[model samples]
Target: MTALHCDGSLTADRASYGGIIRDDNSVLGMELLAILRGVTLCIQKDLLRVSIRSYSKLAVDILNGIVSCPWSLQALKVRITSLMEQLQRKEIRHVWRELNQPADFVAAIDTGDGESFFYPPDFPLDLVELIKNDSDRKTYFRTPSH
Candidate 1:
């Protein structure tokens, strides 16, 4: 499944953990990504002390949608809130589609004889691609050796 890290800016005291709920309309793969991300972190830190395995491409795409979910409408917010309260947690993990392109490619772009894009009733291809491309290009330019 797709796993990612996110960072947010703060002005005053501290930043709220930024977490997104996957779009429920999509497949459960996105949810799996969130779970996998947590599992991955725990394994890396040797905290939970458990074995972890990567998820399939389908799972990753689903996770991408999940990562884009707005927590305000997600039911998982309650559990997150409770856990944070008990742990004094501040940082939130999130998986965004752009950052998890491998899955996106497998599910859409890399699919054999398949379409690589979608156009919602109001969404424009150029605009969306333009924004994503612009950000990536910016990053490439800002690299230390650039």
Candidate 2:
């Protein structure tokens, strides 16, 4: 089984989405983009069984058909559904941000308007550390907002 964590980040003037840095300013859009990218990657690599984790409940709900996809996202919804049908087994789940730190870190990286695909050997040190901690099942505490 292939396990993937997906996330998206948005700021007032910029966005890092789906391993690609772009001008897309919608958070939910970015979240869906991440899932799409992850799912596509899995299919391309012939990973037939997959578990996808995302911190965006809305994105998870949309993918799971528990909620209606927004009009603006209909195309993305269709594409994701089409890709998911190719998988032999798949699960898309909503998780808390703390539990998805590695993906969040990747989503927050500035790739200078380009996409990044990190093979294990090419992962940034910080992301590598995060992945190690995740594999070790280390707990992360969420800090309260000011």
Candidate that scores best on lDDT: 2
Model 2 global lDDT (CA atoms, 0 to 1) = 0.87
- Model 1 lDDT-worst window of ten: 49-58
Off by over 4 Å in 1: 1-24, 27-29, 32-74, 93-96, 100-146
lDDT of each: 0.43, 0.87
**For every model shown, what is its TM-score relative to the native structure?**
0.24, 0.78
Q: Residues 1-146, candidate 2, lDDT per residue (tens digit)?
A: 22344689899998886643443226789899989999999999999899989989988998899989888889998999999999999999999987899999988988888797778989999999999998999987778889
